[model samples]
Target: MNELQNTLRRLLRVVIGGRWGVFAWSLSGASALAVILWGLKAVAIPLLMIKTASWGIWGLGVIRESKLRTPIRP
Candidate 1:
């Protein structure tokens, strides 16, 4: 019982902490879909642009971190 309680507590904490990122990603996808489906090309384009820019920034960060983690070949 004690072990089960500890496991549940950790799971709850992880879920709570990750909720915001999950929500934001879901909202971004949903909004983009809404714009596209509703024939709001003008609005959709800008929203997609923003999404792409964010992905680019995220990719850059990942790349930088990966490089830092790797040993230099020189």
Candidate 2:
């Protein structure tokens, strides 16, 4: 469980670390959104899993940081 939390925190940091990170996240988010909106059902389902995981990492990291009074540096 601790490893999972640490891994997620690291991933969240990478997501907001720099312009490259922002661009990568944006592309993934857009691609996931597009797939959910109009892509084939088969492909969209798998992409949805990935998208949910990404969002979950971000959400959990924020919540954990807040509870621990740790700064989430942008």
Candidate 3:
């Protein structure tokens, strides 16, 4: 029972981690924007552009974090 509780706590912590929040928000926002754009027009070019830009921003953030060598907090 103790081991099961410990494992459950660990999994909960991982699911609720700080980085997960950031990543989830970024992904959700991008998806929402794409959906909005698609509803406005059938063409997918604008949505693609938005997706690329979003990913580019994410990449830049990763690069900056890597260069700073900051330890990611849970």
Candidate 4:
């Protein structure tokens, strides 16, 4: 698992550490993930929605805290 993670990191570094790299990689990864999710229909849809909403809520909470001048806690 560590080896696979290392290999992916290297591959992504090479792919994303080039000209206009961030945008290119973001698009490539998002498209590939979309295709995989599309293939996994039923399960992926709910999971994606759940994950997105969780992130959205967490993000809004962070912004709210920031606006309220609250210190972030661990």
Task: Find the candidate with the highest lDDT and give its number.
Answer: 2
Clashes of each: 0, 0, 0, 0
lDDT of each: 0.58, 0.61, 0.58, 0.53
lDDT of 4 by residue, 1-74 (tens): 99789767655544444333444445446645766866655456765665565445445544543444433599
Clashing pairs in 2: none
Of the candidates numbered 2 and 4, which has the greater TM-score value?
Answer: 2
lDDT agreement of model 1 with the native:
0.58
- Consecutive 10-residue window with the lowest summed lDDT within model 1: 13-22
RMSD of 3: 7.1
lDDT of 2: 0.61
Segments of candidate 3 deviating more than 4 angstroms: 1-43, 70-74
Reference-based TM-score, model 2: 0.37
* Local lDDT at 68 for model 3: 47
Q: After superposition, how far is residue 70 of candidate 2 from its true place, in Å?
A: 6.3
As for candidate 4, its clashing pairs are none
Q: Which candidate has the top score in TM-score?
A: 3
Residue range with the least summed lDDT across 10 consecutive positions in model 3:
12-21
Please provide, for model 2 over 1-74, each residue's C-alpha lDDT reduced to its tens digit, 9 standing for 90 to 100. Answer: 99889878765665463343454467568767777787767576777676676566555655554545454699
Q: Rank the candidates by TM-score, best first.
A: 3, 1, 2, 4
How far out, in Å, is residue 3 in model 2? 33
**Candidate 3 lDDT (Cα, whole model)?**
0.58
Clashing residue pairs in candidate 1 are none
